[model samples]
Target: MQTQDSRARPLLIYLHGFLSSPQSFKCQLMREWLTANNPHIVFCAPQVLPYPAIAQQSLVGLLEGFLRSANCGPVGLLGSSMGGFWCTYLGERLHLPAVLINPAVRPSRFMPAYVGRVLRPYSGGTQEYRLTEADVDTMGRLEAELAQPLHSRYWLLSQRGDETLDYRDAENFYRSQRQTVEEGGDHGFQGFARYCAPIVEFLFNQQ
Candidate 1:
């Protein structure tokens, strides 16, 4: 459920990377900054299910519930890594503005090898979740759903040196939309904060 402040201003829904949570460093930092700098903007980062099977409809339902619950007028989506994949899928259906960070464009093809069983790392904890093939297949189907042509309502941010996801994926996917490709940065961009200012400006400035 959304908080009271979320009722005001445009909605900003953040989707963290695979095996990550809303409590991620970037998510927390953005939350604090937005709360102080743009209190009117609603910030939502739900803790999504780890498995791909539940992740698909779960994420969509969450977004739908958020919009209905808050009565959000306009919405902006920010997604990182695998979450970026989800943002693309949702953007197709919602037609809302979005900012994708090191997004996983072809995760269906990328993660096929590990479809049966996979281990995920947890943040600040020595724990991992064992994923099932069903989960991976569902995620692949979700990616397929978003394989349509790109729209103008999307923006992509990626770094060439990302070790996790190939930067080319984002470049190709969002080629028609606004894009910012950084050189020599890792999967987690070292200068994410620098990009945040412009992203916020662009999102808020949009019609």
Candidate 2:
């Protein structure tokens, strides 16, 4: 199966969590694993914008660019936290398979705490942006998609010790899909490197 991919470069795009970047630990771990084991696969972890509307736009643009590139093959998504939420939106829209790690069920439900606060954006530089009502509203629109049944193409990875968001919400949200519920791990998700192989297999082998 690995050699078969040599004929066509399969892509694995990782989406980092909020206030995180392509260099985040999970992103780096995934990136490093792919580089060492799946040389035929193209790994992409775009630095998504902080704002909801533009973040979606950036993801879309990345996908488009990848699809247009030569030797493009099957595309899969892997997202953590907020990125997992956006990944669901994109995966459902395109009927693509995705691996979600501690995804936010309803971002708008807890987004109020972030509004109007001067927050550091991704890539963690000096520039900061205030979370606004418009950003939160855009998130609501994305959340609205959850009202319908989700495609059973997701592999959910959640930890009960997640302090920021409730693991139960994700369990209920993705009840129909595959999942891994671990105990005593925080929102960052402990020992994620352990699942690196299965994650690639699930995403890459999916149609």
Candidate 3:
């Protein structure tokens, strides 16, 4: 099969986890890999807001603009953690394929624990960001919308040893879709570089 990059310029959008930035390790790794192997591909990893509702709006706007500018091409998504939750939302809305790494299958279930003050280690500043009821509500909306899977267009990558989130949630949620359950690793997904090729293939090759 012909690669999407070979047919048209591929637009790959990387969505980082909550409190994470585009400067994340996986984002940088994918950027570097695309630069070296598929220079023709256009990669974008926009920095989204901390708030769930605001973040969804920002991502939707960014993706709309990207689609407009690209005109006609394959658009792929790569999301980790909370970003994965958003990715599933977008994938369902746009009928696009995505690669989710240790995705938060039900973020609303755990948002209550973080409803108060929180430190954003990736914020680059000492300031803290507060999670509000609206954030929790937004997560609930997203979670509710995910009641139905989008067929088999997703590539779920999870690690059994993920300390932050339960990998079984993703495993159970994406049971019918393509998935990789590793024996040992954390939420960061150690040795993620090894899957870059497969991720690219899965996202861009989907019909």
Candidate 4:
């Protein structure tokens, strides 16, 4: 990140995990915490579409547009689960730093099971999605887009007890990076709120 713009507030975009939304617990906690404690920081947690390709288009458009519309200051990225996959993609392309929480290392492997009509539980099951074989196959595009050493720009947080994802995958892949691997937390990254302040400090304050 460069010098603070002095024209607009710094921004932090939180990317929610698979089958999740901006309404997810962690996203809400981030929003509320910033509102109360760091109101100067701009926080955004867009509901990423389930489909891989479209989600990419929307997010890229959102971020690029935000930068074009305002002289914003430093930007931060935080992602969980599938969003972690995207946080890496976007962070790399934008040359920004990120903090990933139990992120999915190989979504294409498991996404095949989700290929077809899907119900998003986080959206009260109101959001109906169709996951295609093409979507499953395209997951690697984002993974392959990573151009830098994971340790150079990412801070990882994973737990051994994640039933949805194997924590070892992230631990091993992000090895040598600054990370925290807890003993018994689930895919939701147990006790996520405690790190909100520190996460902001890392993304906005650190190089």
Candidate achieving the largest lDDT: 2
TM-score of each: 0.87, 0.92, 0.91, 0.91
- The superposed Cα distance between candidate 3 and the true structure at residue 175, in angstroms, equals 1.0
Which rank order by TM-score, best down to worst?
Answer: 2, 4, 3, 1
Worst 10 residues of 1 by lDDT: 115-124
State the local distance difference test value for candidate 4. 0.85
Worst 10 residues of 4 by lDDT: 143-152
Among all candidates shown, the one with the greatest TM-score: 2
Question: Once superposed on the true structure, which residue ranges of model 1 sit more than 4 Å away at CA?
Answer: 1-7, 112-120, 125-128
Ranking by lDDT: 2, 4, 3, 1
Error of 3 at 155 (Å): 0.5
The CA-based lDDT of model 2 is what?
0.87
The residue-by-residue lDDT of candidate 4 on 14-58, one tens digit each, is 999988888898899999999999999999999898888889999
Inter-residue clash pairs, candidate 3: none
**Candidate 3 structure quality by residue, lDDT tens digits, 34-133:** 9999887789998866688888788888877767773457899999998898889888877789999999988888878878877574748665788988
Taking every candidate in turn, the Cα RMSD to the unseen true structure, in Å, is: 3.4, 2.6, 3.3, 3.0
Roughly what TM-score does model 1 have, to 2 decimal places? Answer: 0.87
Q: What is the lDDT of candidate 1?
A: 0.78
